[model samples]
Target: MKELIEVLVERKQKNASPLPYHGWVGPCTQVSLLYDGFRLGDASNYDSVKSFAQLMWPDGHPRFCKSMHTMATQIEELNKLIWLMIIDSYGLGEKWESVMINYKMLVQFMKYMAPPPGVYERGLFAHTDKPVSTIICDDQVLGLEVEVKDGQWIKLSLSPSSFCFVVGDPLRAWSNGRLKAVNHRIMMSGDNGRYSIAAFVIPIEGTIIKAPKELIDEQHPQLYKDFDFMEFFLFAFSDPAKHIDSGEQLHAFASLSPPISN
Candidate 1:
């Protein structure tokens, strides 16, 4: 992982194009992976054709490419299992099985070093993972923080082998507000540097993301209108102004119908 971080930093130093993040946070480098677990899936063909690893790592980095492929593949598998469990918990297991869940995984490597004394801390601003979910694997340093009730930011303590999960917009809408898509931020400490690889789990672009019929009853009214995953994804990256904070864009899709009478 350290070697991968070195490559990312070195490439960024060379002015490689950073992922356009709608001006939300500072610069970072990422490589999107292929394979939606189906041959000719066409779910990630556009990205896979680009070969992000080859583009970023370039020559003399066979190990880097190999590692990226291995990690992305493993994470994709994990993504499916986790999604299955999540939907099943909401009693949508049988319905979910009939629909294929697609995801585009990215190997994001960020390097955060302590800023000079007395300067305003420079780190990623508070935001939510816009996809289905994010599986974060951080090195020793703990710079990640989650927003709890009352808007308090809580620091995380992660072990070397532990991975943290952050829920995302799609699931929150799909679950009719039953699930929580946490608001989180990164704060680099004055004495340590941090690096992490996060797999941003996205869903099938064409899938309509609305609360399942079975999950929505008189007691559990639909909170959000039906929306396509790709549309929401594009909206998020298209304009930071629209979504300046967590739940802003999502709230835009709120359903206004009166609750169903029991």
Candidate 2:
């Protein structure tokens, strides 16, 4: 991981050309490089792995490519295991394979530049992920923050080897709101740049996301209706107001109407 980050940073320093954007059904693959103040590069699907690697390192870095491929395989396996545990907990063990059939993993490499002297900048805005789950592996920089249920933000100080697993909107809906998606942001400060790799478990283009019957009962009512994952993903990016808060995005896109009482 350290070697990969070093190579990427070196490449970014040497190259000043603008990165090309690639369009997909959703926002995950929209921009290969997202440059506002910081840099964020994404490689999704199998074909994109090599393509993005070549784009970043034009001359080709064999070791970097190999490391990314290996890390992606490991993350993919971990995603499967995590979903298995989640489904079993919700009594949907038998549906695990079917549920995962339309899902794929996306790997993102992010580099947050150091803030200006005596000023802290928001590297990334606070928003919930649109995927099922995301696993983040960060360097020894303390900038990642998560908002808890009490409306307080907690900054995460993580070791280079530690991984943070975060739930996303899709997982929250699939579990009938049993699991709450995390709202997170990156706040950059200090003199050193922060680098992190994230593996996101995202659904394919037309996957219909809905909570299973086992997860919805009278005590636990269905919070979301059956909705196309891609549709909601696109809506989240297109709607101006929804872009501000992901909770609002989910509510606007797929929340079910409550039944009227006597």
Candidate 3:
């Protein structure tokens, strides 16, 4: 991880950009490595498999390109295992294999350096993960915070080696209101830098996301409408700076609900 951080800092120093949203060389400079999903229509989509470093510094491989790719793959596999376990624990039965068959995933290696004092107070804004689940390695940072339903903020003190598993917007929708996507943010500590890796496990585009029949009943009526994953994907990225209220925003696609009695 230290090596990867060094590589990113070097790249930023050499090829930094003024655009705040560019993932590789801007304000929130992070590298995202995508894995199998609908976007890669076929195995022959060679261009899609190129490393991030290769994309930015196409002339040659960055120092830790291989290491970063290897680390991303490892995290991707781990995410798959954790996803399977969550499904099994819910007793989704034979529905498991067919449910999220088209899901896509990517690992984000983020470097949120300590900004010059008073320049930037927050690193990442408050937002929910769009993936089904997110696993984070905070790297002993003390800046991660979660906002519960009551609007109270809870600070997470992570151990260097500990992992934080977070439920994302997709899972909340998939579980039919049984789960809530956590709203989280990253604040600048103003002392030292922070390096954290996050794996976002998302569903494939065009896949219909909704609650399973088993989880929907008279008492537990469907809380959300079934919608295309691709549509949701577009909505999610429509505004990179927008902070979404997961449930409220998703309600835009809500199916007709039972009318209240007069």
lDDT of each: 0.62, 0.68, 0.61
Measured by TM-score, the strongest candidate is 2
- Flag regions of model 3 displaced more than 4 Å: 1-25, 28-50, 116-120, 239-247, 259-262
List the candidate numbers ranked by lDDT, top first. Answer: 2, 1, 3
Poorly placed runs, candidate 2 (over 4 Å): 1-47, 240-244, 259-262
lDDT of 3 by residue, 44-77 (tens): 1233334344534545454445555565566677
Clashes in predicted model 3: 1
Regions more than 4 Å wrong, model 1? 1-50, 117-122, 238-244, 254-262
Residues 135-165 of candidate 2: C-alpha lDDT, one tens digit per residue: 9988878889999889999999887677889
Model 1 residue 55 lDDT score: 45
Error of 2 at 258 (Å): 0.7
| Alpha-carbon lDDT of model 3 | 0.61
TM-score of 3: 0.75
Query: For model 1, how does the per-residue alpha-carbon lDDT over 193-238 read when each residue is reduced to its tens digit?
Result: 6676677765644777766677677888777778888777777666
Task: Please give each candidate's TM-score.
Answer: 0.78, 0.80, 0.75
Error of 3 at 101 (Å): 4.2
